[model samples]
Target chain A: MSVAGSDFAVRVEGLEKSFGHWPVLWDLDLTLDWGQLLVLFGANAVGKTTLLRILSTQARPDAGTLSVAGYDPVRTPNAVRRRIGVVGHQTCLYDDLTCRENLVYYGRLFGLTDIPRRVDEAISRVSLGHRADQRVRTLSNGMQKRASIARAILHRPPLLLLDEPEAGLDQESTVMLQGLLKEWAESGGAAIMTTHNVDLGLAWGETGKIGVLADGKVQVQEPGRYANVAEFRQVLSSSLVTRQRN
Target chain B: MVLVWKDILLEVRSRELVISVLVFGLLVAVVFNFALDVTPQRVTAIAPGILWVAFAFAATMAMSRAFVREREQGGLEGLLLSPVSRDAIFLGKALTNLLFMLLVEMVLLPVFAVLFGFSAMSFTLIGTIVLATLGFSLVGTLFSAIAAQTRSREIMLPVLFFPVILPVIIGAVEASTRAIGGETTVGLGRWLPLLAVFDALFLVICPWVFSFVVEE
Candidate 1:
């Protein structure tokens, strides 16, 4: 593994993906580094999930060179997969299993030997230790989402890709999730998350990077350039008004 | 190795697959009992075929649910995101399904023997059950994973499973019939080879095909 610089964790060049005849991602280029929390903001059908899936090795790119953790995702997906964790809309958990069981199941999948301790730590980290033995199907939507987060981070991969992690989450839950992301970034992990909530994207501070993806193209990339909270809010409101007008 | 055990442990607690397969197998056996009007001797002679049929249908039901349940809970993507090899996932699912199918077979065997008035305590019959169930579950597991991603997954599973496991079914039924009829080991020479061939083919093919099926 070659760490070209202290800042780079992912380098994607000319990444292109197509489903049948329709292209989903076209010549996409992005680079992420340590302690960076990047939010991909996009609306429906804009290829947010497709881009994340390709980056996570859940889908293949038709053309281009992409590298995550110094391994090419297209050619050596398994190596890239080892360094990344993804959370998508689907909870991807066994409903019949308990919260602890779900975490242990994934922990073992990643070949973590101290499974019981890891499961307990993850459950507590998600603040679900009280419901650890409860069946996942019995939990509330927010609780289930937390369980999904616990499973995704069980291996502590350097790169995290979350597809709409804030969708449908209430304010309190969203705040808690944001705090978790902040801590993860502080610990030198890089995160790329896609969200429909523009407010959540703007709330991420200096360590955060924001990208606007519309119609499969990254229209804007803002890295700590918003003047202040008020200015960020104004930009967000104006963007929404413009979109509504269009 | 850990993935396989994780699947098994989860199944042990939930017991969903086993319960479904057992109930379905019993229902099929009862319906067949009333549907077929034959003497005790004739029923004993045909018991192996009926047993295999029940297992085939019941195992398909259990196997399809193996991955579908994960997909519904959003666990499939998590598993895909893990560093585990795709082949390990395939093998883990197949082995877990095999374990569930075997559990169903163990419970069904005595009930089947009682229903047909055949002796249940035969090592040869148990061996045949093991071989047949393994082959059926392997094919069933792979097909279930493939069908789970389709639009009509519930309807697609049996459509995909049966056609592929036809040879295994034939071999299992033939081998089982010979064993139940008190035939010597010589009678299994042909069917056992066929079962082995099918098992080897599936163990090789399912892993390769699974990488494609799980890709979004």
Candidate 2:
């Protein structure tokens, strides 16, 4: 299910990041070629979000060569940003603005032409049309997740970084998110998502890849390595044990 | 342009920052009016200081609101994730806060004039307001971004904000005092330059600091 081309959409080598004196994401290496989804599995506070942030050009690595969409995040963040969309735990929607208004704001920021039309289409696509006019703060958690999905896909970026996109999502929303990721992958975009729910993350597809991060390092990663959820779980538990032992 | 418009539209839709701050500024003036009874002469003498103090306080409200809104909703990260340059984002936020404060000051000045029974409807006073407010908003926007990252942002913002902008407060009060006292030429020549220099310095520095801070 992986797209062709050795040309990677994202590349990181020996990436080292630390907050204060505590090291996170130590000597990490990751790569995503075009049209791939790498569901990064990790325990909480294991620097999955930090890795995504570095890839999204929101943070710099302490010691690493990081590139996104052919641009170094540190040297050419604007270019990297232009090629990416990120949805963290927070929906990133302005509480005061309606869903439509938030999309328009982002649409304008991305310089997307026909903003109103695009916003309408995005809202409707996310099944948020009924709540489009409601302030985002007033929306339910699931609805806000849908709104954030709309925002992320508004620009149709080449790379999407999602930290816990399924956190507040319902079953239906989860299915929608899967479909959205599938569509994005089909369209030659790459995504790196971090989630604690190994089952949902593994369910991305048989063609997708999974990486388990443990002890500040990506311990096990292979494309379509887990044929089923049981296999993924077995490896994950082993990794956790290894992490604890180390 | 998009950044500026987003902030303005957000403010217009919610009316949270401007309305609260305008009310706060007016309330400060009202409280001052009640606390001290003064003749028109005395009003002119002390009203500039009082008016600026009110504006300064109100501006902090707006500044904190602007940064808090971004931090609370993760809007800053959203903005950073966008293709827009950090400088553009900084300018947009600073300009929005500046516009918000200017609007509050505009509304408050008239109410202040009526309350204090004094006339400060001079172009010089308005210019001083613009310059001093530009400086205040510039510095406030930067500190707000910095403070927003801290746990105690409400306390952090004021602690970092006021001391840095004391020069602007002094320059604004001095300039407004002269303008309100009908000595516009002399006062503006002396104090407006100070305000202008302060404004110019931050207009360049704050955006740079904001770019650095947000990236961190």
Candidate 3:
């Protein structure tokens, strides 16, 4: 099937997926424009990673009408993969390889020209130039996350699909992420990051949209509409409580 | 076995996997030499079986580790997320596994020669090794990727591996025996062409199947 919109970074309608008998996501609809940032918040096991996996072409939806970067994920996965970058809980860097080596490897995989220059630029972009020579196993969690971010943007992809990018980040790494996100917005590239921290999620989309996945569907709102974080927290707790009750 | 990644991963890799395969192969040769009592008359028959068994089992065990690093470090997802064709990913990995298995086989061949009382060097035996290793390594590499995704990968690999590679095991043994016996036409001529056919067939099928195996 042909994608209707050429502008949306991601568009999903009535997406459904399940593991065995447990339904993780059903009839879920969401969209992110190329110039917007979307922060997706959900409780543990609420299919946050599953949704991101579908978008990244790592997992297939049981049923859905979906388009990522104007390409159907299953029909044209390579095209979709080319248009997107992904960062999950794992660093995706080889432990045996140095940080610079990891970026250069990805640069070659993505068929980027001027690889040494791109690797240098990406390493510097994440402020990993000093430690770029070290193997990934030697780096701390924060440094690895920074290197992962470098790998993600090594191809200069138009969209970034991040799954809980802030889970264990320290203050410095978190601050580095904020700068990256700010630059991500400024570059007009789209991003959909799954996060559990309400404050962090809301902060990610400062002026953009924040979404909550509950009962197999998402309810999105502009954080600007809420008076403070507590309001959004109340709504989130109430919805999750309602789900648990059912 | 080695990783594929456009051959760049070779530079970063440690020597552990190579050492593992070589040592495992030599262990098989040593055990077989002590376990069996073979004179020159039986050497042609029994030695070929022992040699291929060493190569097949050792290569199977070693090739399974090829994807462990990728899966454990979550780098497989990174590869899947790339714009590179899935077929290229599979072929590159299968070919690299082939390369590594050949390297270990070269190291072990002389050891097997001393143990089994056979000539160390023969073009026909080398040809048989290359063709047969290619077939099994392609199948092994594909199964490694599949088994790596599952929870009981260790159990899954052998359960899935031995049955599929039985043909290569038989073909290599037959061809190696003929190559060692200096029969230029009878068994080697028949088995070599057949082994090449199987290699070509696996070379085509494994990569295509690998695309689906990696998908969720």
DockQ of each: 0.62, 0.78, 0.63
**Candidate 1 A-chain TM?**
0.88
Fnat, model by model in order, equals: 0.86, 0.88, 0.86
Once fitted onto the true fold, the runs of candidate 3 whose alpha carbons sit more than 4 angstroms away are: A1-5, A222-228, A237-246, B1-12
lDDT of 2: 0.83
TM-score of 1: 0.91
Point to the candidate with the largest DockQ.
2
Model number 2 iRMSD: 1.1
TM-scores, chain B, all models: 0.94, 0.95, 0.92
The C-alpha stretches of model 2 lying farther than 4 A from their native spots are A1-6, A222-231, A237-246, B34-41, B183-187
Error of 2 at B215 (Å): 0.7
True contacts kept of 2: 0.88
- lDDT per residue, candidate 1, A1-246, as tens digits? 223443577778777877897767787888877788888776666688888888888888888877787787767887787788777897787877788877877787777888898888877887888899999889988888888888877777777888889865667778777888888888888889887666677776346777766555564555347777677656644443323212
Structural similarity to truth (TM-score) of each candidate: 0.91, 0.93, 0.94
Residue pairs in candidate 2 whose N, alpha carbon or C atoms collide under 3 angstroms: none
Ranking by DockQ: 2, 3, 1
Show model 1 residue runs off by greater than 4 Å.
A1-7, A223-246, B183-186
